[model samples]
Target: MTSTDAVPTTAPAPTEAPSSGIPDLWFELPPGFLEFDLEEDSEERMVRMADAVDPLFADATPEQKLSLVVSGEYILQTMIAGGAEHVSACLLRMSDGKLSQATLCVIIERPDVGPESQDRRGTARRTAVQWHEQHPDAEVALIMLPYGPSALCIRDQGLQLPGVLFGLDDPIPTTIRQVQFCVPLRTGPGSALFLFMTEDIEHWAEYLDVVSGIMKSVSADEPDGDSKPAADNPDAGGTESQA
Candidate 1:
């Protein structure tokens, strides 16, 4: 239940490694994006949530506070269930009480091969092809990010029930647009970062660019004192995302 700071337009600088031995991943998020760590325990998570929304609940009734806490827990659990290591959300108020939102989920994985030996272009192409197979209508492309070769996929995800997060009893279904990026990490063998962003279809283009900038800002510190931006080599051959 520690005090939380205001949401930053960019991520903070990397700190020392955690006690769990996992190195902190560094990345920036656009303005209005609030990020939550999905790896914390329930009590810690709840405390973090309370800290973030303290101003909103400062003068609210007990019942209202409970409802808000419950809704927040539900959203956290859903993200944890989906294997997200971290989640960030940007919500904009729209006319007629509607909301335009962009959500980003980060998932990290370690593979068998190291970054030096991995085939970046082939990896990017394979990822694109796999996603294309699963979503025939998706627009898949290989992109060269500052970090390295990466895959980008964009597609309409039909209707989704996001109202649950807002505590709506009978929320309307809204169409979702998704943009996913798979970028190989400089961290040893097959370490990669996956960014999955979902947004309201009406604001897909704007949000996609925001997420892309976020992706470009991602970097990791290596064990041998090397930095991600300088350690990994970027390929210039891949096509860029249309956004």
Candidate 2:
């Protein structure tokens, strides 16, 4: 579950687009977050990257182009924040030897809608209900964290998913616990970043604290020279096993 084991692959070939001269963003990671090296060639990686951009571009209106571009920037910055080529993830090992994971993503709202038009809490509760229905064996609850009102924190039990890039057949614990949080950027509609943490139920308080720290430490500033870069080897590593 540590960052040291990530096997990086060659960076994907950059696509040719109009050069607006806006340098790409690289977000700063909070202390103790481990970035899983996401291979560039994985199907899951491609799906995630596509998810970040595709939805924003679909059925586009002439005036929506600028919003789409800004939304894409938020998605890209979020990808960098979690140290992922496409989808970002950070794993933590708790004191009880249980594994905890945080999967990060960005969701861009449609351009025509006002940010306040949507009901975040109601939507989040419905999401929680859907997750519970998907995993009947797990306990589920909607929660509020210190990360402010725009954040959605959902606690669930017995539902363990592998890393974002790990395929369906990847070995994982038969049972798992997770806390998923979605925090909308203050930039209004077409911008929000989220993180989900999976860990043992016993470590609920601890994981909550960890996510809180992450929310507090997140920044869009460029990383320092001393900051660690994403994993660069080309090997596919196994997911961290649950203890």
Candidate 3:
């Protein structure tokens, strides 16, 4: 569940076109809220990366991709939503213990009509901006863990996942006592990058930064489906861990 265990395989051999979802290098400074400019030709990259995710991409049915948009939002309401329209529930790993927390949402979709859409990334960003206006009280940030990271780590690290990622084999938990939101983005000096509060903020950011970097590096190899992490990973957290 920790960063140490989430490292993806190293980069694949070079090829034509932007085969990798991540760029060649990522800086090692502030952690967590990873942001990057959207490439004009990013749709293919998005599909490629999404397609490479473990089971989701391997034998993914068209129906599943359309449904994984809000896996946990409906579940974590009272504990962590902090008054927002769209929320993401996460299992936070704090220095001491777990806590339930929620983060605002940014839903993106593909502009082009394809079974594998690329514009979903943009849809999410635009929605986030709109969400911020609707609820002036919530904190929001954009930190996209590469598809490989999201698919591989969310379950193993016990992080609560959105509907888009949940599966029938991955049954939803019936009850939950605690949750935590881990947002490692630092907006500015003394400012919260992810809008929620938690300890080890920068340290968490370091985790995201490093993870993002690694995924980006390995994104090109047409992600393989090695043995996934065991389910004992306990990947079910609440709103308390996301902002």
Candidate 4:
């Protein structure tokens, strides 16, 4: 995808209604990603996570559990503060037995005007142009997805969160690179869904491919009970879920 070129496309397909209230769309995420339930309160979410990870932490001491829960709470608070409708973490075990992880956040946006007031394709093109104008160095391209047109932006140097988020006292902040795709949804006028992923630069290439595959798998309709998770499909990269 070039900086200013629109990738070739096939005809657009019809939009699907969101299965849930907050997220008007559904997509998938690769294995190792633990999706947080945004509707639940922090305490409830913590309990959920604890239960999910109980097997792994079955032998943990009281102090270890306390420290881990505190850290988890901080991360959850930050994600909620950023208006993330869907939040997930991809944790992998490195060769040396160390843990490596990345994060993906999805935020759904609704148009302010009436549905008839805006054109989906036009809005996507405008978004691409505006992003280029604001960040000339960042790579921007207009691409066609199965559902419709979208604006994809890649920035090597992305947002840096404060150290406090990780319970660090150092003045240096944590740096992360981001790949974002703004997909215009047909659900409403000027409505769009943004998929933002942040990861270490070393794993950028691998994660980019993963995110691209996830974007390609996005659909308006939720998957039926018979549908297989991405893990079961060798060609697919993520598990179907509402976001």
User: Across residues 121-229, which tens digit of lDDT does each residue of candidate 2 receive?
Assistant: 5544665676678766655566543322333436454433342323346634434345444432223322233544343456667766655554443332223323222
Could you tell me every candidate's TM-score relative to the true structure? 0.66, 0.41, 0.23, 0.68
Candidate order, TM-score descending: 4, 1, 2, 3
**Lowest lDDT 10-residue stretch of candidate 3:** 184-193
List pairs with backbone clashes in candidate 2: 8-233
Q: Write the per-residue lDDT of candidate 4 for residues 155-204, one digit (tens) a residue.
A: 76534444563567754344567777787664555444555544456656
Name the candidate, 1 or 4, with the larger TM-score value: 4
Residue ranges of candidate 2 with Cα displaced over 4 Å: 1-28, 36-39, 43-86, 96-102, 114-148, 157-176, 191-193, 219-243
In model 3, what is the error at residue 112, expressed in angstroms? 11
lDDT of 3 by residue, 122-221 (tens): 4345445655575455444443443211211121122333333454555443322221122211111010112222223434543343344433332212
Best prediction by TM-score? 4
RMSD of every prediction: 6.8, 17.0, 17.8, 10.3
Better of 1 and 2 by lDDT: 1
**How displaced is residue 84 in candidate 4, in Å?**
2.2
Cα lDDT of candidate 4 equals 0.58
